[model samples]
Target: MTALKRRGTFAYFLVLVTMLLVWPMGVILMWAYTPWSKSVKVAITICLTILTVLTVHSVCYFRIMPS
Candidate 1:
């Protein structure tokens, strides 16, 4: 594979792994390093934001009270 292809593959894996494990950094990396268009990035950003909001709301709404 060409150097550019290898770099792109590496960036892809890095973004995927980081998105699962450490997502704030992953967003930055996706915007800065990946070849995705602005619209795709914006869509993913919106989805991630919505997911985060839902997760936070679920946790806050479902917390157990101490006896």
Candidate 2:
């Protein structure tokens, strides 16, 4: 196969891996926060946001990287 095709395949795999992570991460974030702990909620929110951004960025990065 061509280099571009290989990169595209890698990108697809990355996307799938990220998608698989989203649900468990989300659940963990939810469980980490409760009504009593506003601090934990805010921290979890920030972490989840960063995680999402990084996942998107990584997928795009791999797609553009030379293969």
Candidate 3:
């Protein structure tokens, strides 16, 4: 039963983390698409790319390797 509870809690934590991650990606993308300057767009694009890579790494770390 304890393992079940832990698993449930972990699932909730993953959901929460995913939700948290979605907000920033959405926000950055929204701004990235707007009629902004090229430099600003490039900066956010770089940030978004880096953010995407990091998020993928995080998911692999948390979801793939965990017992």
Candidate 4:
């Protein structure tokens, strides 16, 4: 069982935006301190995982041509 804290709405939103836009490592690190719920944390992890995979896919497929 994990101990949860009481962080306000702003912190919650910050974590969310951090999860979406910031580096995935940052979000993963924040999970230890942030007071967001388990579900929210899970959602963040899922979203980051999906986005990272997509990002990797895009990078792999991207073609650079000198014109």
Can you rank all candidates by TM-score, best first?
1, 4, 2, 3
lDDT of 3 at 8: 66
Model 2: lowest-lDDT 10 consecutive positions: 27-36
RMSDs, each prediction?
Answer: 1.8, 16.8, 15.4, 6.1
Per-model lDDT: 0.89, 0.63, 0.64, 0.68
Q: Write the per-residue lDDT of candidate 3 for residues 1-67, one digit (tens) a residue.
A: 6997887677655544543577565445445434557786577557767878998999989997858
* lDDT winner, 1 or 3: 1
Candidate 4 weakest ten by summed lDDT: 1-10
Error of 4 at 49 (Å): 1.2
Error of 3 at 45 (Å): 0.5
Query: Which prediction has the highest TM-score against the true structure?
Result: 1
Give model 1 RMSD, 1 decimal.
1.8
Models 1 onward score TM values of 0.88, 0.48, 0.44, 0.55
**Evaluated with lDDT, which candidate comes out highest?**
1
Greater-TM-score candidate between 2 and 3: 2
lDDT tens readout by residue for model 4, 1-67:
3233334555666666776577575577568767668997788688778888998888777754334
Sort by lDDT, best first.
Answer: 1, 4, 3, 2
Q: Better model by TM-score, 3 or 4?
A: 4
lDDT at position 16, candidate 4: 61
Assess candidate 2 and give its TM-score to the true structure: 0.48
